[model samples]
Target: MKSAAVPRSAPAFTPRALACALSYCFIVAPAASQNQPHQGAELPAVVITGARFPAPAAESPIGATVISAEQIRRAGVLDVNSAIRKIGGVYGRQSLDGSPDFGLDLRGFGANSGQNLVILVDGVRMNENELSGAILASIPVDTVERIEITRGGSSVLYGEGATGGVINVITKRGAGAGAGAGQASGYHGSLSLERGRFDQHDARARVAYGQGPLSFDLAAAHQGTDNYRANNAFRQKSISGGFQWAAEGTRLGMRLDSARQDMRLPGSLTEQQFIDNPRQSLTPNDHGSTDIDRVTAFAEHRIGSLELAAELAHREREVRAAYGLLFESAYRSRQTQFSPRLRHSARVDGLHNEFVAGVDLVRWQRDTSFGSSASQDSKALYLRDELRFAQLSNARLAVGARHERFEKDEANAMLGVPAGAQSQNGWSLEGSIDVAPSLTLHAKAGRSYRIPNADENGYRSSGALLDVQTSRDLELGVRAGSDARSVTARVFRHRLHNEIFFDPTLSGGWGANTNLDPTRRQGVELEGQLSLGQAWRLSGQWQHVEAQFTAGPNAGREMVLVPKNVVSTRLAWTPAAPHSAELGAQWVGSQRYGNDFTNTCGARIPSYATVDARYAYRVGAWEAAVSGLNLGDRQYYSNAFGCRSGIYPSDGRQLKLSLRYQF
Candidate 1:
């Protein structure tokens, strides 16, 4: 791989730090410029779909990065994974089969990375766990209208588990202007079919229409493929539908989504398996299956300066899998949650003040046919207020707090454990100050605590209590940029207490839940976008992470899979009227440590880089595109943890072509 264009400097600012700085700096310029006094029929107020108040992206105070719908269509991305991977400061890890179940490494946080990043679908959080973490694999992108990305901890306005950042996925809404300016009225829809080089086949369709106050959207998709390798084959089916009703001061909506997946489990093995026959590590009957269903109903009311929103949702999830000769498991889980929020915007003492408050209540139940059955409940209330100090040039201050409680119930008597529960309370404070019209500084320091899950705390046939994981994170950063160029950088440090992990030394011998040590992770990221001309654009980024087991039996050991370096670059060209071209490449460094700390890979897996290219053309109302993934055909392991068993090589060359029409 070519060396990075930017010089490698000491890792000072991490992803969290850079994100904070960039966010503070980016939010001011556009909003201040858009707020300048204007005349005549004020260009129809643009509504920011992710926020409660009706504010334009260019006028809202919250730091936001918008990805236009046109961009997605032009890029010919299949789902959310392809859509956001190109964005700077973003990293992802996928299964050997390249399915959507990926672990996101945003900035520096690892393992269940989405736990700190919140995702909202039309202003409602998409997180399903009692801990409130995002389930990216379950979210369908077919109905997404736009995406608003806010870098940095958002617990102040959003609730817990918002330490990394917030990514709001806005769904299509009617009664607003048509997708294209001056294209109101009429109906539109699209259908696409894709067949890639590796026997990958996908078919999708969507339809939508609006007359006045009522509108609806329906979409469905199916994808299947033979194993990229011996044990990587998989199949998936999904369907979703939504309806909306809007009037002068109120809007109501409902949505239903479901997904089913059948996956072959390619289990990795010990040193013996690698020396013997690696291909034999995956059994013929070893497989994993999942089914998820969700329903949500919400209402919004806008009365003058006050806006009120509320939502009720239900979700059911099931997972079945077989693990080598040790154990075969089947898990069923259900969750119900209620969220209500209120926002008020007005001029207080001649200064623009926005206050947002909300409450979340969740109830979740889990049952393992051959294991344990348990139920957990949690509730939280949070409030945040942003004040634009009147008369202060490009300055703003924010304050917020949250209160929470957790409870649990046990039903499996064989475990010989009594039914007991634990409660945890935590709070956070965040602030941002724009120093100049183009530069801004931001900081957030918060304490987050999570109670142990049923399996971690109550299930113990051998009489052992699983430890709870808790942490305190402090972050700071700065960002600067303009129309022609933009740069973002950040630094952060996290301290974990009693970091419960897998024990890896029991009868079943897998990583069993246990709090064994203290750990820390800190890093920095630098990213920039440069537009050389109207038809030419260049973007690049670099990240460095350093995680340590500061104290405990694992002291001084580097965290697993926390690579020291990550980099990427992209060049886009639009030379003529009907065609556009793009070339991009990404590099991922090697990572270590095995399924648990006890088992470790002593050698580096080697770093590898891959390239992607695309060609797109438009003719009247019809658009066509062809794309190639891993054009370089570089041989690498996507899942190095399982590579020793030869079960996780990256997919071979994949090519896809698509065509769409607007009716």
Candidate 2:
């Protein structure tokens, strides 16, 4: 074996001291920036999706990080993972397969991160009911307006799978210029082309035309790559078209989107093999393909202080995977969703107040090549209200609650798997207060629940299904800032019972997903931004997490594949309007290997750090940019399914250049 074997080692730091410092520094600095933005103030918030309405970050408790489209473009990021990972509190593990479906972890959920968070696209649930998780790469970065990452359990409004947090990606469409952009008029469009390492090629274009109360738009993108590893190539293409109309206080819109992709899977490698040659393919013939189509229709009406909105959507997806001769399969799924919501704003006893109420109904059905099938149905209702006392430093207080019910059913058998039907309910409560105009304090308590996905239950030891997993969540945070300099600091804890995960040692070494002993996850997240003068800007996030079992012989043992510390920072120089440059760095701390429940690996996925830089020049309607990833070309691995093997190394350094034109 090579020296790259992961090693378990204690990090050098004191959590208590750091936590205190984080709060003190942020609290005191707000006063300095009140008259003006701190230095380089963090990007101004366009909207706080965490509130489920048009509210600014200073008025909301969740205090989410908002990544703008301009930031993504300037950094030359191509996917959602790369676009938002720098915000500090979240960690996106590299995809094990050829797809860009990064398993994003909020507050250290480990291998089952997909089941601990919710991802929404314009209010449409992107998470799948089964193991197939959300497909982030399907939405081209070019079609994004902004991404809101609320890093804490948000089940009160988002429902289910929001124990860790929620990621809401707001896509750019003809449906108005996004939150608070008001109504756009005239015609707008853009075209772009890019090429990079590994024989990668990408092309995209979008156009929008608006006149009076009606507007329409269309967008298309295609990407192909030889990939960094052998047999890990893919070709993908997507197209979307939409139309929207607005008049008086009423608005309506509809959209249709489709995508197709074909990819070759290189599979995983043994530790020694990966160390020898990270790009070699262990299963050269493995490959797969997927297709998805979706449509959404929405309407809204506003009267005085009251507003009503609703949406109906349907989607279909099919996937085929071939893992050599006899081990091949196909999966298909269908989903439907209907949501209705109402918002009213007014004043009670001379105090400003607002209330929001909503309902969500969803259905999902999936079938596998092995003749097994599963279905899920959900119904939920939620309500929240905010009251403000302008006479007292414009202080505000808000509270929210939600109740949801879910039903699941499964049939047939794959690999002697047992099927069952089950029911579950979830609920939450959250509140926040503004102690000062620039500083807000928030506290939230919630209960999160999840039923086993079809794959998680496939190998249950008994005919009875695995128990429904649940967690008690608590979070507290302080948000402070002026214009340029701002800070968001938070501390959170989640105690989980019946946590579901895969254990390779179970069933005598034959891996199987199962519910485990009680476990607890606690963490601290801090994000701050500062700008000096007009040419330089600084921003970043730092996170520390502890995930461990709370019961049994392995009590207090750290969970596998959960990083202890992650930091992302960047420095940008915009000396002038036409030329700009940025340098960014990220460090991921070490943790146990996947499925290492016994914690006997004696080794951990080694900690690694990387740097990236980008430079761009613009003139008229044209722009050109160049970027480099992993400038140091450090060799490391973030994905390992076991202590002995199943290692997937990270990508080496790569370079890219792109050109874009806007009109």
Candidate 3:
């Protein structure tokens, strides 16, 4: 490895210094001149995740971020996790086994990372009701059209497990409306290949066809890597297809997806072992594999001012794991879901009113080792109303409510627990006012809940069933500027009760599921984007959070693995047509270890910063790019197990070269 002119260590800057520097940059930024385009000339792009109907970010009551496919390509990111990490108020860490799947933490809920966040694909819930989080790797980047991220408590409209936020991924199905309206018939395709360090290889292909009210899309991807550390190799293959038909005022669509993955688990290293050599493997013989398949069908019809939509989906997954010579396990799960919704738009006394109501039913069953079986059924009904007061400077008011019932049946081979049931209800209210031509003020208050999954309840025999976790949140924010330049800042506070988590101090050395006392989380997020002339752009994000146990044995102690501050900035230069380049840096603050909940161990992880750069060129139908990650070769740990074991080290400096051909 070669060193740059600057020192390898990150710059020494305290939180206060960082904040002042960023604020200075925003204040002294240059303004557009006579030759530059007007800031508000173009309307903002619309988002579909948090609003009753698709609305622009400037008009949205909730804090949201939208990432388009063009931005993903410019950033040279191969996975969804990498793309999301650049956003504010969102953080993620890979599994100890070094798999592509990532566990996300939103709003400082590190203890319930997987269960607190919600993930969706085309409005379909993808977050499994099991121990594992969403299978994000199964969806290829080439198939994604856009990703909408709503940051706040969203349970009133999205159902349970949205105490933190929601991520909705929308995939491409066809060309423009002209093609689907019988105006054109054509076929398009693209093929891409990438190679990087650690013997990594990736290949992807996509094809689409559209003709006279019918369209079809198919995509497939394969990736394999000999990872940086021992016993951390992984291979995955995924394929997806979609078909859609549109005629008159009705539309129908169907989608199918499948994925398979196999990987070796390196486990966690001890503190001394990490200092000696981070590349060493602690569990050389441990391995895991997963197979998944899913199918979904949906339809929508419009009549005058009323619209109705329905969807049905089924999914199956199989997992196998071998823990060295200790033991091997096999598990299988099947899930089915049905959703129906209705939407109506009307004018009531000069006010534009939009109403949406929906029902969701989901059933899941799992068969584990020792002949143990567990099943759950969830039913929810929700309604939302949005009123645009044309009489009051176009101000908006939105209200939503939801009711859910959950039933669990477990035939535990060891505990022999019977069936159980739980019920929850929540509501939310949001309002936005246009204080000025280019400024908007918004406030929202909401309540959300999350129920324990089978694994969290008692899948380990030593664990026991836990109560539902509930939260109340309040937020106020402001949005200024327009499409050319914009700034958004939000401050939020949340109080949670009956927070369920794994306690290593209980059940001897083995952890058990239990409810903790009251907890509190408060934070501030700031995001800004500036268009510097026609050839340059700048974007920045900063987040500060304080999460603590308000009333518990660990009262006033900060939560583990929840960093207090995160900052990121990027600069993009497109000097001319067909050529572009970008440089970015991210800084993460130090955090407490998982087992050090009491903050009495006097041990903490250190902070780290990394730089990334990408350059791309395009000509005709061919494009090529080169990207570098962790340019400083900084050593850092993204996650940890406990005080007894070492942390999970992230990958070192690496480079990739990619080529793509489109027709």
Candidate 4:
């Protein structure tokens, strides 16, 4: 095995992205000096992105964004992946299982997306301990109430795996959901059906009942698609429900969810094959199947500015798959988790103060048909405190810390490994101040870490454990908004030590997951939304990241699969009546292909842009929508294992029509 001998051109930073970053100063000028309350309505209504913390959105030390349920319906987003991409401004690559499940990258942590970022459903960790990552396709958008995205290292609150960021998907519980809007104490039901290209079909139904202090609902969803590529068919079925009782600041709930999925793998193609017909599959008969069951119980109580909250969850997951038409295996894992936390507010020395503390206990075990079994147990304790002074223009200061320990035992029927014990410590300091009525300034510095997971530890070039990954993070940002406009701008950098990643250039191309030398990730991010007149609105995001090895063999070289520039913008006509329309465009800059660790790939993965749109009509308890994805019919490949020959081309174009009825 060898690195590609020829070199390819890299994408130059675009002027538009630079201008978008530069223009933030101008947009905040007037608001920078005016002291006033937020009097205007926002696109999604600002809220705390991370559920663990109760701080206001404006005072958050990190970049945060929220996408509401109404926004999801207007955009015709069908899954969590699509909602994250189109509305949250993250970039996602089509997964082998299809569009609904994707590998989403944030802040340029490419290739190992699932490891770097954290995904949560109702405050339960969804990320797995394997390279296969989380199962996201099965979460129907219709069941979601909102999605919260927070950027920068959040290990102090989410655990060791949150170096990139965190995304929390909140589900609807009827009754008091949506702050009591469109929800009353009564019976409710809804049904939805959809059809699209490539024989895609979907059905979803929900039934709910709410009566003073109690709300219960049940939902089921089914989806099937003969995807864009040959032999790439996917099918999924899921049923989920929950019941909640709330009254006088006390809340109690229990949720149960189950899902199954089956898909045929359509391997990769060579550069020549991609150029000729990207839709063809090299390995047509390969396939996979997955089954998952999860249950969670949660409780919260409030008393005298003191809040107590907790969640207990248990999950079972199994996957059987064949890759490259030869390798075959089955994996089964069960996880049980208990998380309890509380928030307390107090006034001391004439200043307002807030305090938070939490504990996490997790037990996970796994068994594989390939003669392997492993188990890991962890315990963590964390605390955070913030102080606010009204005399200093409502300024706030905060600090937080976390300490976690892990114990593991793993082995193979054919091979043996030593049991291990490890621990990680993290800390953060941040502050924010209201510079003007509608403008805020903030900064954060933190230290974060990640321990090697079961799968990564299983594959070793020397048959030994890998190193723990760590990073020092820094950020500076501003948030400004008014009646008709809103904007957020931030510049951040992370200096890393022992960054964990797979090295294709290792062990003579046999490939191994290993920790790399010193590395750095730095970038600029801008997000804004503007209301145009009464019926029109515009929203967009621009991001530029530099991911490079600072030392070692690949020193000064760009990391694989990390695009340097990405831009997304949308224009919408959202009148108050019967018709609504939306148009969106995304341009992703090119970067080196996966496995091109030496930065010698013959050709970089080419840059590409996609256009999508939707139109909807509604008339009393019923709505219909027509939507299209990749309307440009762009031919592109976002993933490749080693080089050009390992390319997996993305879908070209597709359309969908859906109808919904409420009763």
For this target, which candidate reaches the highest lDDT against the unseen true structure? 4
Candidate 2 per-residue lDDT over residues 1-663, each given as its tens digit = 123333334335434454455445544544534444332234666565645665665564455677877777777777777786753336788776666666788889888898888988888988888776788787877778788888776777888778888888877645343323543667777899999998888899988877777888888899888877899888989998888888888888998889999999888888788766788897878999999998999898899999888889999999999997669999999999999999999976668888999999999999888887887788888888877777766665666777777676766644555444555555556656668766777777777777787677776655677888888988888877655656877889999999888877778889777888899999888887655555666677778999999998789888999988887778888775688888988778888889788888877788888789999899999989998888877777788888858887777788999999988
Query: Scored by Cα lDDT, where does model 4 land?
Result: 0.82
- By TM-score, highest first, what's the ranking? 3, 4, 2, 1
* lDDT of each residue in 1-663, candidate 3, tens digit only: 332221133358866576666655554456642247633222354544445344455455367788776677778777776777753326777566566666777777875777888888877888877778888888888878778888889998788888888888877767534232222457887899999998888999998888778888899999988777889999999999998887776878899999999998888876677666777787889999989999999888889998888879999999999998989999999999998998898997989888899999999999987576899999999999988887786688999999999999887656555578999999999998888877888999989988988877763323346788999989999988766677788899889998877776777767677787898889988887777777777778877889999996788988888888878888888776688888998888877788887787666766778889999898999989999888878767768767635577777788889999987
Model 2 whole-model lDDT (C-alpha atoms):
0.78
Candidate 3 pairs with clashing backbones: none
The candidate 2 region of ten consecutive residues with least summed lDDT is 1-10
User: How accurate locally, in lDDT, is each candidate?
Assistant: 0.64, 0.78, 0.79, 0.82
Where does candidate 3 stray beyond 4 Å?
1-10, 33-35, 38-43, 50-61, 87-89, 176-185, 348-350, 459-464
TM-score of each: 0.84, 0.92, 0.94, 0.93
Query: Could you give candidate 1's per-residue lDDT for residues 576-649 as a string of tens digits?
Result: 55887778877776665334353255565456677888888878777788898878665555454432433255
- TM-score: the better of candidates 2 and 3: 3
| Greater-lDDT candidate between 1 and 3 | 3
TM-score between candidate 4 and the true structure: 0.93
